[model samples]
Target: MKKNLNFLMGAVLLMATVLFASCNAEDDFLVSPVDSTGAVTRSVTTDPYVIDFANVPAAYTASDKYGANLYTGGAGQITEGYKVQLGNSGTYVQFPVNYLEQEWGEEPRPWQYDYWNGGLAVSDYTDITDGTYLNQCSVYNGGIAGVDNDKFVVAYGYSDFYNDPLSTYDKCAKIYLTDATGYTVVEEGTPVEGTVKTGTFNSVYVCNTTYSQIVMRDGNSFTTGGKSLEEQEGWFKVEFIGFASSDTSVAPTGKVTYYLANFDKSKEEESGLHGEIRTGWNQVDLTDLGTGVHMVVVNFVGSDKSDYGLNTPAYCALDNLSISL
Candidate 1:
């Protein structure tokens, strides 16, 4: 059964230095600090490939050619002005980048300048106050690993897109595996680039965005008939569904569901279970999805429903995503 959900500018010679420094920093982050013998400690089999947005190359985040900026609802946002180049096809990660040209420069496209559509986006916004504004795209605890961590990815899950075959909303963070360089989609029997032999779903850290946390804890003016989760006896969660290589039709190896908020009156009354509005960062293990999983589709579900789908804010912040091959 299918579960329904809704849901850089930079430099040069100093640029080369920045890119080299960024890669080295990412390596350093993945492995421990070097020792007396200049040997870094890391278990190739155990240490998964982690994607920390803070270490994204300067060229991708700052320069004019392949830059991406967070949607700040101001002059800083870049809807269609920027482009992203996937370095290689072996194994690459991508967040949705809906170009304005395709949709008449719409304001709510996946990569729009104002409101976020259902998709994945890179963000470092840290405002935790004013949950009323849909544009406040920050984790409640600020970061998954720590409060001061530089960057994380925000995901908006729309069930209508995932459930509707004709829907065009891009609603998931994708890791593509290609047979060779320059390819964007996964190919069966094609080797993934790097040392990874087979793609494995490890884990990811998830937390409620400020907009979601507040709306779940307290009623918001919009949606759910202006009722909180407590009042509506509702729940909110995201599902990570893993698919086989080159195949994405409903069938998946497995699915992992992580709840962002749950307010069941029965459970609270009978088992002494207090309502849970997720705070800080919680790790959702995906090992159950198993190895050889090339793609994972994430979507959100909530008890508050209208004809349009989930009424609760469908936003979640993710960080420290670990994948192994």
Candidate 2:
């Protein structure tokens, strides 16, 4: 009997030891440094490059009379030539700009216009539903007119703020320009890129002379060298590229949240203009962007909880906004 008991005790001890070893192996796997194989993933460790507001060019700092106020209610007017509508229930109005004719004389080129009823018209402008419409206005006589006239009408759709006013995120979109030289501009059809998971959406616009405009997910937008008397001459659209995420576990879902920086009201008031302008990183998702030969724009949309206004108006700044693989 004593011999049998000893054997049983020994077996139990051996089983316990095996179980403990298995647990230790799992712990080591969790903490081990990942191999640098192409298959093995790594996080973006390099700190994002921040823009030096002091380095802003004189052209970027110039005042823009055409700069539109975003907070105005109902079919807000953008400069003397453009009008914007707010809300979900409304008729689609055509936009007529003389600049189109001045740029492409006698030739009727395809022009894309963004409609923001509920939120800013970003890349999702193509996803216009019954409640929202981002219609392309036909060009005539090389130029579309109707700034002081009623030829163009502004429309609106459902207001995200009405449903949830306390929400931190705001739905917005922007257009940018890009040319053969790989210079991106803030123009029509600029691709919007970013991740809108849970609540936060941030993105950076790489501001370069090669690039023209930095359209925000919010209704407000900016140009690099300020506004020129010749409009369409310097404006074009950027193609869609991809984005990178700081956290790999939370894979981006081709959506983004809204963040406003650089322009502070108190600071703007302190200065002669609206506010001091600063530049920082704008976070985004790059899942949609494929490899090589593409431009990108970032947009943010969601329930309205944040204010879209700058006490100081300034050009948009961007850095390290690129796609790899």
Candidate 3:
């Protein structure tokens, strides 16, 4: 009887150990591993690709050579003006003059003409009340038509700009796209949270001080047949442009910052892309993206560390936003 009782106790302990081991295995499957190399790798069983707004068509005025109003507004107010044009290349679309006013502050902060000591210097506008302006601009061409339908991937690149600070925000631009109905905000640029990418420079009015910073959010997205495309097969691309002023009274400094974020419900956290002080633009490619409705968000940040505090004014331009396939 004694021997039988001992045997039964041993059996019960073994069973408990086995059960505990099984539970641990299950937990391991749910949590991913963090490698020592500072790189994270995960095993995704579902579709990995998604669409992004890179280059959407721009809204042009009746005077534009590329058919007037090729892109019409869908949900928001549409303005008619000469689409912001890139230099001599004619490769990019243009941003509107009121972009900053529409995106950030309510009032228009006009440039202030002032004098310091014995020389003449201008007051750089910083408050959102000052207004929206674009002093610089550029364009990017993401090779889309060449890739196969299966190769649905897009990317956007960002670079730095050098010009007058006071006129940086004079007229910024962004690209948009429309389906059979009209244009929708496919991709655009916005202000970022930090300093501009370029080096430090003197403020227009505060000549004794030098500061550098330009933060704006710029991005693009993709859509199909008038609907937000979030499937694994869709793709998109975009590029950023920086504009500056020519007058010494309006010296602009800073490089473009880049960010890419996805709006899918499943992958919200890992859906963001970013780059800073980049010599060139950064590219984000979403291939084999999931299906359904989707949206892509781009962010641009500027830095202002002048005597005016963190509120020093800045500006940028967007253009050549497009979508295909």
Candidate 4:
């Protein structure tokens, strides 16, 4: 009887140990949607090259104008550098070096006639629903098509906050985009009669249920770059592009240019994005000018421009900056 009692107690202890182990494993594997700082967090990589973008509290909306020296670099004197912003659209958007404060839910507070005049537009100017509508606007935080990065900064070509190339948020990092992973797009395969297509992204296939194009699961839509299936037939459409130059002499001067993106394109269009950003970590090479590059500025411009204003939002995303100091 004594032996049997001891056996029973041992069995109970083993079961308890298993349960405790399982619970600990689950806790370690959990991925939080919003980071502890409440700011959106992207690729949780231990890569050494990644920038030192620290998270601020959600209420921190402080922003600075451009043209000031950016990097303090632990030295009392300001180090000559620019803060690199990665457009969720895959373009490089630059802010004043002082604009380094990466905050969460930072709304577009315009400083000009049409910077972020969301209420001025017939509809919400910030509305990028149709891919075409958000011209000259600003794209803030986003969750994209695949698990590229949990969160990132987005800036369109014309997204210089004060619209001044001479000054204001004008510097961008030069990066080489080389992979498209987990990129999810939807085709309006056999569109139901009432389905309404929205954004006119190049990757989107507009047709009825009987048409042939990109394949998407029925009754459910795919999500990418911070949006779900774009149209009713194709509710959410997203297009990401990027541009760079070997010339780092100034902002927007590109005698030599480079194209980068994840997806494939038949021909080179005049738009900024070379291709869409893919899922997983991609290999980006930023050596257009070779090593010893002190710094590079992003000159984000777009085709949708006129005297009155520019088109497309000002936003971009960047991470894992590979450079030699």
Point out the worst 10-residue segment of candidate 2 by lDDT. 85-94
Candidate 2 segments whose C-alpha is farther than 4 A from its true place: 1-56, 62-288, 304-325
Model 1: CA > 4 A from native? 1-46, 57-90, 98-117, 142-148, 161-170, 173-198, 265-273
The lDDT for every candidate, in the order shown, is: 0.56, 0.24, 0.23, 0.26
Each model's TM-score, in the order given? 0.66, 0.22, 0.23, 0.31
Q: What is the lDDT of candidate 2?
A: 0.24
C-alpha RMSD by candidate, in order: 13.0, 22.9, 23.7, 19.5
Determine the backbone clash count of candidate 4. Answer: 48
lDDT of 3 by residue, 1-325 (tens): 9999999999999999998898544221222222212223223212111111122223221112111222234222223222211111111121222222232235564221101000101111122211122211111112111112111111111212432134332232222111121222233433211111111111100000111112222211211222322332221212232222222133222222232222234433333422222112233222222121112212122232223221222222121122111
Descending-TM-score candidate ranking? 1, 4, 3, 2
lDDT of 1 at 206: 82
Tens digits of per-residue lDDT for model 4, 70-165? 222322212111232221222221222222222234564212111121110000112223232212221211312112322222222332334444
Which candidate model has the greater TM-score, 1 or 3? Answer: 1
Where is model 4 more than 4 Å wrong at Cα? 1-48, 52-151, 155-283
Candidate 3: what lDDT? Answer: 0.23
